[model samples]
Target chain A: AQSVTQLDSQVPVFEEAPVELRCNYSSSVSVYLFWYVQYPNQGLQLLLKYLSGSTLVKGINGFEAEFNKSQTSFHLRKPSVHISDTAEYFCAVIPVYNTDKLIFGTGTRLQVFP
Target chain B: DTAVSQTPKYLVTQMGNDKSIKCEQNLGHDTMYWYKQDSKKFLKIMFSYNNKELIINETVPNRFSPKSPDKAHLNLHINSLELGDSAVYFCASSQVVTGDNYGYTFGSGTRLTVV
Candidate 1:
């Protein structure tokens, strides 16, 4: 089985400031990493993913994440956050083989203030 | 057009009542999934279907049943709803591709509140 842990429960940052959301995963085998964002009363939307290529993966809304194999971490980062970026973020992982079901973290709320 | 759509975005019902949440995906994906998000904002996969075949069924209670009539539709039917079952249920679908990567497209989610 695969599991994910989001270190931070909430991260507050001023608008235009950089932000980082930490995520860690534990799996018996190799896995795929993903980040998702959800606004209030909305379902999760895919942000970025790290599969096999470069360690640095970029996604929509100017968000990016780095996959670190040794540390079993995939942290999401944004150079400058906008007020609209405030949302709940989730880090997920799926085993290399087996089913495509994703194991999500507890989620971290990113609050971008003006 | 919405990639993944769910009907009755909000469902409020009483205990012991049965309700069904409908989900549809038009992305031509071969896999569909049902997930539950608790009040604490923890997302967990409940069931997954591929090509209308049940593939992954989590340790969800028997009262929670998932039915996939076709490749594009997956519905969740809950019997004897309980207070703990009240949460946001999301429907997602993904296409099986290489790179060990598959992007999931999620529905707007149905918020179920059992009184």
Candidate 2:
């Protein structure tokens, strides 16, 4: 079985400050990783995905993540964040065997203050 | 147009009552799924349908049934709802290609409250 763990339950940062949301996954074989963001009372939106190729992948809203196979982690980072960036971020994984089942981790609440 | 949409954005009902939540996807995706988000915002997949055929059914209670009339729609019917059933349910769709599948497009979600 595959699972995702997000160490931080909540992260507080001031506007224009940098932030990193850590995510770790457990899988024996290769897996696909994804990051999703959900605003208040809204569905989740895909932030970025790591399927193949380079270790670092970039996505919308100026967010990027690096897939570290040795550490079995995919951490999301932003050089600077805005007030509108406040939302719940989730890290999900799909084991190569069962691509249909997406296992999501407990979300991390990103609270941006002014 | 919304890629995925779920009806009854909010549903509040009493325990032991039965209710259904409907989902439709405008995207021509062949697969649809239902996910439950608990009060703590943890998400878990409940059911999945591909081309109106049941494919993946997690270890969910039998009281929670899913129906897919067509490839574009998947509905969930809950029986004898309990307070634990009170959570946000999300509908999502995706197109599966040969080897790898794309990411899912999620609906706004239905907030079900059982009192």
Candidate 3:
């Protein structure tokens, strides 16, 4: 079985400040990692994904994440953020060889202010 | 255009009433999924269909049934809805890219409220 844990339930950052949302996973097999962002009253949008190669993946809206296999973690980071960046972010995992079902984390609420 | 779309953006109904939410994906993807976001903002997979065949069915009760008539459409029907059933339901689609599974395109979501 695969599970995703996003440690930060809420992260408050001032505008133009850097932020990082931590996500860790536990799986017995190889898995695919992804970060999804959901704006207020909107569905989730795919931020980025790590399938194979390139530990670092850049996503939309100037967000990036590094996949650390040894840490069993994929943490999303941004050098700077705007007020519009406030949203709920989810970390998901899918087994590489088994079903393509996505197991999502509880979510991290990113609150950016000026 | 919206790639994955769901009908009834907001549904407010009484308990014991059965309602259905429809979902459609224009993208030529082989997989479709239904996810529920609870009040705590936890997204959990309820069901998944691939090419009109059921593939993943979580521990959801039988009252919550999913119908996939074809590869592009997946509908969820909730019978005897309870207050706990009040949540945001999302529809998503995904496909293979370069021999690996890619991320999903999600619908705006349907907010169901049972009073």
User: Best by lDDT, which number?
Assistant: 2
Q: Who is ahead in DockQ, 2 or 3?
A: 3
> How far out, in Å, is residue A113 in model 2?
0.9
DockQ of predicted model 3: 0.74
Instruction: Name the 10 consecutive residues with the lowest summed lDDT in model 1 chain A.
Output: A94-103
Candidate 3 per-residue lDDT over residues A1-114, each given as its tens digit: 898999999999999999999999999999989999999999999999998989999989999999999999999999999999999999999887764588999999999999
Ranking by DockQ: 3, 1, 2
lDDT tens digits, residues A1-114, model 2?
Answer: 899999999999999999999999999878989999999999999999988889999999999999999999999999999999999999999876666888999999999999
Comparing only chain B with the true structure, the TM-scores of all models are 0.96, 0.95, 0.96
Model 1 lDDT vs. the true structure? 0.93
TM-score winner between candidates 2 and 3: 3
Across A1-114, the per-residue lDDT of candidate 1 in tens digits comes to 789999899999999999999999999899888999999888888999988889999999999999999999999999999999999999998876764788899999999999
Please give the clash total of every predicted structure, in order: 0, 0, 0
| Model 2 regions more than 4 Å off | B98-101
lDDT of 2: 0.94
Query: lDDT for every model?
Result: 0.93, 0.94, 0.93
